[model samples]
Target: MKRQPKGTRIRLLLAAFAAATPVAYGFFWSEVRGRGTPDGSSIEVRVPEGATSLEVAGVLAAEGFIFRPRVFDAYVRLKGQGRQLKAGRYEIPRGASYSYLLKVLQTGSVVTTPLTIPEGLRVPQVAERLAAYVGDSTATVLAWLTDPKRIGELGVPGPTIEGYLFPETYRFAEGVGIPVIVRAMVGRYKAFWGTEERARAAALGLDEREIVTLASIVEKEVRWGEERPVVAGVYWNRLERDMLLQADPTVQYALGEPRARLLYRGIDSVADHPYNTYTQPGLPPGPIASPGAASLHAALHPADHDYIFFVARNDGSHEFSRTLREHNNARNRIRLARESAER
Candidate 1:
């Protein structure tokens, strides 16, 4: 066989090397693509809205969530997740594989903070709790809640979204805006106010706003689940008889702050405020606190009783009475029991 020219042989070797380059690259990529960086710490990565895959990869790499931005971008594209990456604040774990991190971003598994708004919390209280969770101040959340336009947009028929901020446990994405938080709570209230609940309110000759107001009062009055409807019935009876509600919660609310215990002087003094149900002939202008679903239901469907009064038994329950004499007797009995216990 004739020997090839040295230059031709050299060209052949170069061609062979070029042809094997992609295979070598494939082996190297496989080895590193699935391997996680040796950092066992967590880092937060924020992908802004409308960010491209390349931009997201850069953010992750810069944040130390990944070792190679270009490799991440290529992997995302290969997995058809280039357009699926969601915009949010994500807590990327250290040593997470590219695939795992990509999945987290694509699925929008953003970090969330849990916030629980308990029953009978006023808007201000709720705002304070929300501020602690979302890094917004109570004033900021209150401003968002009290904005008439925002309240109107939420379909809450009031000057403020007081009763419309449904009390429930919520998980919010980190760095969520105030409007988004308010809207979420109000939206939950709207959703809970189903057609049946609305119909019940109409049947009771009360609008949605009135029902919510009464429910809030009932929520503040009773802590026992079974006592809600009975307490609601007492209030309904008082309203029907044109009698004073004399709800202590209303007095506390009118004081513009929470009190560990309501004094008789405070109750008497708050009678001048419009929210003073003891002096005001009708329901207050709006809900004093956020009522849960149970309280709302109780307001719409009060127990069928002639109870016009109720006094707490100091046991997370109340004693109902149909007549003033009976109510006074119950109060005296409660006082005596307390005195006896102290002795």
Candidate 2:
């Protein structure tokens, strides 16, 4: 048999190669872009920790989300994202393309629950909100909060992590731990107290914790912004004169529940409680609630006044008084107005 000429053989080889290239390319595209399940349902895939890109591809393939794991692996490596796939449970569409799967895994787009903690929530209330965030029992969460070692690590002084968790809308990833959430909240609270706020607290002869404690009282006392500083002033004045703070909120705090109308019997019941301001003759042992930014600012910059008493106007406002007689008169006037209106 005679061998073919070199030129003729080369031409035949090129023709054959050219014919197969398009077919191979077509097959590659079809497989990479193809959907996974027949119904286009969403598929749940868990990528184990420290798993390589190829390993992730294999995992997805086992979950019936990918037809060709090598192609997925090649796609990941070609994009220079071999080590970028994060470890987490992912809810990917069954028909997700190579590009979509890579994007989701690389970005670590885990599902999150947005938790909005309102101001004035005590520690227990904060635990309740956290329970919803992480599906932990409230008791478990409270334990985490009150853990002495954890509280020490968090730089909080109290027996529990109270009055330090900042109120905000936080987007917590699913399966996130309680310690992470607590750190996040306390970190926000720390960030809020800048140099100027700290300096003001020093000028007032109060430490950072003391300011927060007073701010918490102001937060529970009045909801209106204008009244916050005024109410703080009355308390500050009382402190200066060594008079009882006599904050109704303190009585409510001692009772462990809010009362629509606090009676004398209720006050007497908790008279021995350390949180009762009427009997304590000063600020309570600590903050009664988590104060918001407004209350914190007001506590730092209380209105310079000699007002020693305040009567709630029942309209989110207060009538400040300079003396006991003035405060008593104001209270009587409010009572008379209420009585007359009742008739």
Candidate 3:
């Protein structure tokens, strides 16, 4: 080939450079804008409070959600969203583009698992439900519940936070620590337990813990709204008369396992157990389960009545009586009705 003039060669090189520059820029832009990974499944990413953009990028990269932390950091800065990154657990969809992820982080679109802690669930039951959503195991949650330091920190008055873990619907981030979850639950209890309730408890010659203990019993005993205060009144009547509570649920609690139906023999056998009200002179040492707001209120404000006994009517309701003879007659009637139905 014939050698070209120096100026012409220089001009040709410049043209080539200009052509290649656009291609390079396009490739870079596409790389930055494209999905970070090939996997199309969802992923969870946790950004701790006060985490810098670089740290967040590193976490994403480590979790296989992103291919390049350095590129992610640069892109975040370029978008002026570095300071907007929020701390939470996010469910990043599979094949999500970098821009989409950035927006999710900036907008605090975290993945929250809804947890419904129903009224009257024991600590173990609560822990099992919690373990299904959070990172902790059931055993870990149980330990946290009984941990003296944790309970003390939360200012719960009992040996464990059994009755104080307010039962309600809560939204928790995936992989949330046990302490944070416990604190949130206890906080909810404190919020619902207002000053007026405390004053009412004091006026009734009971402390907060005693009130919760009685409320837990009421929650387990009755399911109907109108029956709570009536049942609470019956228990109060027994207490005032220095009579044994003789509650069947207390026997079940003492056995550490709930029975579908407690026979007379079973109740007799467990009567001596500390939690059994049939033999115990007073209330159980602590609450058997978490009480709902209505049950708590009922314990604080029991209805004034002369009734001292009740029995389930097998239809989500109860029959009450003011005397032992009437209670026995009602029990006989229920037994006859049950026998007739079975026949």
Candidate 4:
């Protein structure tokens, strides 16, 4: 072989260097900021609360997000984003890169399920509503709800946290615990009572618990906000007069089974029960169900009216009366109207 000139050797070395530089630069850029082509298939993964970057990287590795977790961990920490990892259920694509995964975790764009708890549902019903998200059996969720220690921990004054869980549409993280869900609901309840609400409660000569109890009955009796205050006033008048509330909803609560209508025999059946307000002279031992904000406000601010009785007409509205004779006439009219409609 002939010996080459030193200048020619130097030129060849520089050319090789120039070629390798772009390749290395491209690889570095891809590792730092590029995303992989997403495949259609994805797996669900959960990053636990307070999870470190290395632990999250390990989870991704085991779930097949990446082949090398240490490299990914190093990538996360070196970028000063270790503490930015959020905890929640996530949908990870099979072909995603470390950069993409970090982006998902950093942005905290986790999967959330919207849960709407309607007003007037019992605690057991609320527990059933939470069954799909809590990964527990309905019985287990109920047990969690009725747990004495948990109720005391939550500062609930009621026997079972019945009325404290505010009914609303809540976006809960997928795979969240039952305690977390209940806490969120109770938190909403706490936020609902500002100074104005508390003052109204005091002026009405009622505590939050008593107001919730009455509000629950009002919630069950009426379908519209316009009727809430009037219904509440009927009960308030009965309470003031030392009269039996005779609220059919309270008897229904005692019966525990949903009936299309509460007949006289049904009321007589639970006459001994405290929740049977047709027999009991005052509010029941506790709330029968969760009350909405309007119902709560109505309980605090009942309508000032002399009406002492109300009967549900065939329509959604009710016919209220101030005297027994008037109430009887209204009842007969409602009965005749119903019979006519049936005919």
Q: Which 10 consecutive positions of candidate 1 have the poorest summed lDDT?
A: 27-36
- TM-score, every prediction: 0.82, 0.81, 0.75, 0.81
- Candidate 4 Cα misplacement greater than 4 A, ranges: 1-23, 36-74, 82-87, 91-103
lDDT of 4 at 268: 91
lDDT of 2 by residue, 1-343 (tens): 9997756764565467558797766666677785555565677788888999889989988987778789888767767689999988888877787888889999998766688989999989999989977887999998888777876799875645678888988887767898898889899898888999989999999888778889999999886778889888888888888989888988998999999989999999998999898888777778888888989999999889988888887576788888889999999998888788789
Q: Model 4: per-residue lDDT, tens digit, 1-343?
A: 9976756764565467558797754554465442445668788989999999989988887887775666678678756688999998998887786767888999998988899999999988998889866667899888888887876789866866888889999997776788788889998988888999999999888888889999999999997669999999999998999999888888888998779999999999888999999888788988989999999989999999998999998877899999999999999999999999999
Count steric clashes of candidate 4: 0
The residue pairs in collision within model 3 are none
Candidate 4 lDDT? 0.85
Candidate 3 shows a clash count of 0
lDDT of each: 0.83, 0.84, 0.85, 0.85
Candidate with more favorable, higher lDDT: 1 or 2: 2
RMSD of 4: 8.7
lDDT of 1: 0.83
The candidate, 3 or 4, that scores higher on TM-score is: 4
| Poorest stretch of ten by lDDT in candidate 2 | 9-18
